[model samples]
Target: MATDQHLTEHTTAREELLKGHVLHVVRDTVRLPDGASATREYVLHPGAVAIVPLLDDGRIVLERQYRHPTRQVHVEIPAGKLDAGEGALACGQRELLEETGYVAREWAYAFTMYPTVAYSDEAIEIWFARGLEHRGARLDEGEFLDVIAATPEEFLGWVREGKVNDAKTLASALWIQNVLAGTWKLDWQAPPDQP
Candidate 1:
C-alpha cells in the first residue's frame, strides 16, 4: 500500500469522465510505491445527511418508507439526499423536519460514514437532536413515508425482528446510541438540552 504523502506527491489533478446529475465519475492520476503510475476511476457524490431526533426521555424519531430500489419497506432515521453543495448540518436539520415534522433546537453530530464506498461515493453524516417541537412536514412531491417515534428499545427490537433494514439508518441508529450515552464528540456544538 502507498502512503498518503507518497500518493499526494505523485498526483497532479483529478479529471472527470462522466458528470451526471447526482455524481461525477472521475479518474485520479496517481503513482504507485513501486514507481508505477495509473489512473483509477471513482464515483464522486455530494453526500447525504440524517438525524436521530430524540425526545427528552431518549425516544428516537424514526420513519417507515418503501424503498423501491430494495423492494422493501425500510424503517430508517429521517434522511435525504443532499442538495448540491449543501452543508451536512443544514441537510440533517431539513431532513428531520421535512420527513418527521419535528424541529430540534439541540443538534449534535453523531457520526460520519460512507454508505457504499465501492461503486458509489455516497457518504452520510448523522446528527443527534433534542429540544424538539412538533411541526408540519414539508415533503418532496414524490416522497411517501409514515412517521413514527421509537425508543431505543423499540427500535432495536425492530432491527432484531428484521424490520429496520436500511443500512445507513441502521448504522446511524447504532452510532446515535453512543451519542446519547455521551461517548463521542460531534463537530457541531449542540444546543442546550431540553424536552
Candidate 2:
C-alpha cells in the first residue's frame, strides 16, 4: 500500500556516471516504499529559461537552429542555460539579445515546467516580454540560427502541424496564445533600474 506517508523513495546509493560541459549524468539506487530496490538514471541540469518575446506589432520572436542530438532543425523560443548564480530574468534578457537581437522594457515571469521529469532534473522558466526594441544580434561564436517572427496564431498552427514540437517552445507558444487572449495574466514588470 503506497500511501502519501510512505511513498518517498530513499536513495540507498548514488554514483556519478558522466560529467559533460552541459549535462551531468548520475545513477542512483533507491529503496522503494514497498521495500524493493531499483536503479534510476537521470541527468543533473543547471536549469534554464525560455522567453516568449512579443514585439509591439504583435509578432513573437523565435529561432530555428540545428539540434545535434535530434539531427533536426528545431524552432524554439530564445532560451539558454542559467550561468552559475545567475537570475532567470537576466538569463532571459541575455538570450533574447544574443539570439534574436531584441530587448524588452517590460518582462514577466510566466511559469516553470519540467520537460523530462522521468529522466532529468531540468527545469525551464518561461518568461513573457513586451515593449520590445530591436538591436543588432551578438551571437556566440559558432552559433548559427535563423530568427523568426510570427503571431501567436501562426505559432499555434505550427504546433498543430508538428512543426513546433520542442517542449519548451510548445509551452511558450501556448502561454503566448492564452496571455494575448486575456485568459492568462502575467505579472509584468519594468526592467530593473527603469521606471
Candidate 3:
C-alpha cells in the first residue's frame, strides 16, 4: 500500500559469477536503507510456467520425474522455463503440450511465485487448464518423466503425506484448494489461435 523506500536496497556494484547454459549467477554490492553495505549473490533465471491441467473427470495431470538437484522423484505439475521472448501463457501452453501431450481448450492465470526468493530470481507463473485433448507427449532430448492423473483429494493427500514437496507444486496446491472451494475465482479464457 505505502511506498517501500525504507526497506529498499540500492545496488552499488555488480559482478557476474557464472554464466551457464541454463543458470546465470551474479553478485551485487548493495547500499541498504540503514546505510550499510552488503553483498547479495543470486541466480538470474529466465523465469518459468507451471500448468495445473484439469480433466473432465475432476482429475489433475501431473508428472513424476527424478530431479537431479534434489536426487529424488517428485510429483509435480507440468512446467518448463520460458524461451527467449516467450510470454507466460505461451510458455504454459508449450510446456503443457510438450510435457504431458494434452492441450487445453480453456485456460486461466492462477498466480506467480518465486520459489527461492533469497537466492534465485526465478518467478514461476502458474496456470489452470481444462477441456484437455490428448495428442501425445513430445519430450525434449534426454528428458524423461511419467504423466499421471489424480483426484484432488488424492493429490492433496500425497501433499499431506510429504510426497508432493516441490515448491511450485505446493503453491499450486494452495490455489487448487481455494479454487475448488469457490474461495478464489479464475477468469477462464480460450487458447489463442496457433500460428
User: Which candidate's TM-score is highest?
Assistant: 3
Clashes of 2: 0
What does candidate 1 score on TM?
0.79
Comparing 1 and 3 on lDDT, the stronger one: 3
- Tens digits of per-residue lDDT, candidate 2, 1-195, equal 667848788999999999998879999999999999999999999999999998888988899999999999999999999999988988989888988998899999999999999999999999998998888788999999999998778888999999998999987777777889999999999988321
lDDT of 1 at 14: 86
- Worst lDDT window (10 residues) for model 3? 186-195
**Candidate 1: which stretches are off by over 4 Å?**
1-18, 27-30, 37-39, 182-195
- How far residue 22's Cα lies from its native spot in candidate 1, in Å, is 2.7
TM-score of each: 0.79, 0.94, 0.97
Give the 10-residue window scoring lowest on summed lDDT in candidate 2: 186-195
Instruction: For each of the candidates, give the backbone clash count.
Output: 0, 0, 0
Order by lDDT, highest first: 3, 2, 1
lDDT against the true structure, per candidate, is: 0.78, 0.90, 0.95
- Measured with C-alpha atoms, the lDDT of residue 103 in candidate 3 is 88
lDDT of 3 by residue, 68-125 (tens): 9999999999999999999998998889989999989999999999999999999999
Q: C-alpha displacement of 107 in model 3, angstroms?
A: 0.5
